[model samples]
Target: MNKGLYFWKTSRIPGKKQGIILAVLLAIILGSVSGWYYLVYIPHKKHDEEIQKKKADVANKIKKIDDFYEGQLKGGGIEQFTQLLNEIYQSRMILGLTSYDEKLITCKPDSCTFGYEILKSHVFNVQKKIFWGKEYSASFSNKGINFSGIPSNLKDNTTLTNYRKKRDVAAVDCGRLLNYIYAFNSISDKSDQIIIAKPPASSVLDVESEVKSQKKSYGLLFSTWSMNAKNDPIHIMSIFERQAFKESFIIKGMELKSKALKITGSFVCKSGK
Candidate 1:
């Protein structure tokens, strides 16, 4: 079958009514165009804007990670980022916008260095709060610990320093013992000795330093007379976790007997895995 185009012819109308009809038709066309602008164009424009924003955020993250790889991102990016990477396979944080961990001695493109801390004072300062002072001295099973020798928050750089010049940094491994004191951890003036053992001289020996595959490790062991206070000494500080930090503060063993508490833990003090 063959098909042919058909045409329709209409008679001419008056110009006055034609203008009104033309105006209506023009209004409909404009309305349709405006509708398209509001619906499709506007939505796509907004979507593109969101995509660009996301791209910008991704670019910022990429730059940060690049800085970290290039060793331009200093601070604890090496240590803590490595730790996060280990966890995520490990994971973080666009190399962290800001790194607060201070033990990272040096961060380089090829290799990084971490400063070590003698945790004797780290644990001792926390111990002093529990055992020192007139309030706590009276509540000790022994003569009580005299904290006159060491001030609070003083970390030891005894073997780690050079020629009497100590590394003046509050190490990343600073809060080894303080992690146990949940209630009194952040407080500088620790007045309450009710929740923990006394300041009966606590110490953490640097068991080993970091090797190729091996990281620096520490062993913390201390014994103190039970506090002559109202609360059960060890019950409040329920520190039974294997590792309080990334690779540090591993709870090894704990003992309590006859108003005396002994705490033993492995603080594998290192940058990361």
Candidate 2:
């Protein structure tokens, strides 16, 4: 007999046995496929979904950061602050008031250099014949420019007395002036007081030299002299004193007069940080 023909004949099985064997093999394969789908594929699919959700969260956070930076760029950043300073300076110039030179202005994150000027006065005057007023004196406290002056011998001249009363009232009502002074000083560096000569006693020429000088520094002046009043010549003598300060200035340990007047002014220019 031939070898190949003998092996083929032995390998053949009966019909019923062959069908049963095939069915058992098919069942095993189907069970294995079902197990793989439930145990491996399902878990892997869920993990992939979680990863995608995390990626979406990260993307949203990055977008928010980008939007914030974009908004800052559109707001003009430091340029807006600089423009505010310029407007303030222009307003001062229009009012015939002194202001810091534009070229000299400097800004930082928390503070800026915008020039300021303050004029504070203490005046005492006496007239001999027309108004024989007794010695008058006034002093101010650190609390906020209070004026307390004593005037005497006003019973004979009601006009002079009335004028003196009016002057006194005006002097004490310096709330506006004090507001500006305190506002500027609060933002300044009170380094030193600048001293300059007092202006002339004449009404017309008094502030001429002082304004022209433009000292650009802070100073205080005290002077006393006898000068004829503009219209009256009753041999008047007056003592006048003034305290002035420039921008970026500070007062040495000065307190506010009342709690009602809070310091509300702020710098117009600031750094973009």
Candidate 3:
């Protein structure tokens, strides 16, 4: 045998089993790394990102709330804000808006003639009321307006009832009574889930003539709407406060089996002599 050939023979070549073992070890390492990356690392990373994003969103909302109050002070107090909102809706300017009843954006002033026909027709007998005082053009709330529909604390109706009975009806200004309906609707438009079942026409409205001697009207309201929670359980308290905040409303009844709430209440829209 040649010297080189003798040396090669003495040196052991790895068997098939050894090669297979080495291959198996390599596969195990790669599998472990892939499993860790997909099962453990990826989920943790995604969860962290979600948490961070949620925090950012919450913070932004808080900042907006603070800014809303400060802006309200600068623009004028809540009473002025409320009155302006009522005026805007009453002008039928909101009707011309593309956003329409959503109340998200201030309506652009327009020359839409939808209601003109009603006013022009002689059959309608609409009386024009004029103010001799200075007419200031209407102002508007800040874009992204914040209306805090905070509910007032209430006892029983007896106290209010007694007070109204004792008080002279003639002392009340009818302007506030007319205004309350428009203002209340303005706030209610922003309530969640609660929506108009159908847009009722002028015929649906009950217009009562003023009594000659007393000259009083009590609780004039003509609106019908319905609500059912689509996804999560309804925020019952928040919805109630927003809807009922403008007036006195109570939960008249509820059917527990059907998870139904049957509520009937009237708003305060009293006008007196």
Candidate 4:
């Protein structure tokens, strides 16, 4: 054989073997890549998608709660109602109508006409009177403010008898009377321009005599009635008189003539000093 032919044959055999080895390595690399994509990468991608889905659900729930509160604020709920009450109170204070005044003003029926009208037309519901006493409670209703007066440990006493007599004499509905008392108390609580004198120790007759003797301007004589925790009738009397009376006179006038009488000098709202 020739030397050049022998050398070419030997080189060709090694080159074929090298090509087979390269092909096997390439196949192994491709198989590893395919296995990684199916087993590891695919499961990790699915887990990430689940995590994002859960986060979206939580965000949606939080948004729903926020919307509920926002609706309450805009729909004249408790917060709006409270704000309206504050405005009315401030307006009355500014106009010097903090207390109940029986006298009529030149411009309108009374100094608190605006407040009264607002209360009567919007806030005050006759049904709510059931909740005025200790045993009574109130709840909301579409028809109106519903109230239930639950009778507690009621007792038959002289004060209760006297209160019934007075109510009969005045010819006022029991519910209406309670409503008036509640309204008066509410207004009195919010008033800032009133002077309440201390109660007296004398009898009601003597107090009346002293008031008459003073010869000063007088206003409304407010009489309120309610029941105590023991279900006994409680009578409270408040005077809306002039501020000109001396402290001595007021103290004397605050005395109750009888045990059935209710008198508190703490609530004195004067119109003119």
Backbone clashes, each candidate: 2, 2, 0, 3
Candidates 2 and 3 compared by lDDT, better number: 3
Question: Deviation in angstroms for 231 in model 3?
Answer: 57
Q: Judge candidate 2 against the unseen true structure and give its global Cα lDDT, from 0 to 1.
A: 0.30
lDDT of 3 by residue, 163-236 (tens): 34543322223355335445655665332334443322222113223221222333222233434322111344
Q: Output the better candidate (2/3) by TM-score.
A: 2
Give the C-alpha lDDT of model 3: 0.34
Write out the backbone clash pairs for model 1.
88-91, 131-199
Question: Considering only N, C-alpha and C atoms within 3 Å, which residue pairs clash in candidate 2?
Answer: 194-218, 194-219
* Winner by TM-score between candidate 2 and candidate 1: 2
The segments of candidate 3 whose C-alpha lies over 4 angstroms from its true place after superposition are 2-10, 15-20, 75-273
lDDT (Cα atoms) of all candidates against the true structure: 0.31, 0.30, 0.34, 0.32
lDDT of 3 at 125: 26
Top-lDDT structure, candidate number: 3
TM-score-better candidate, 2 vs 4 = 4
Model 3 clash pairs are: none
Per-residue lDDT of 179 in model 1: 49
After superposition, which runs of candidate 1 have C-alpha atoms over 4 Å from their true positions?
A: 1-13, 72-273
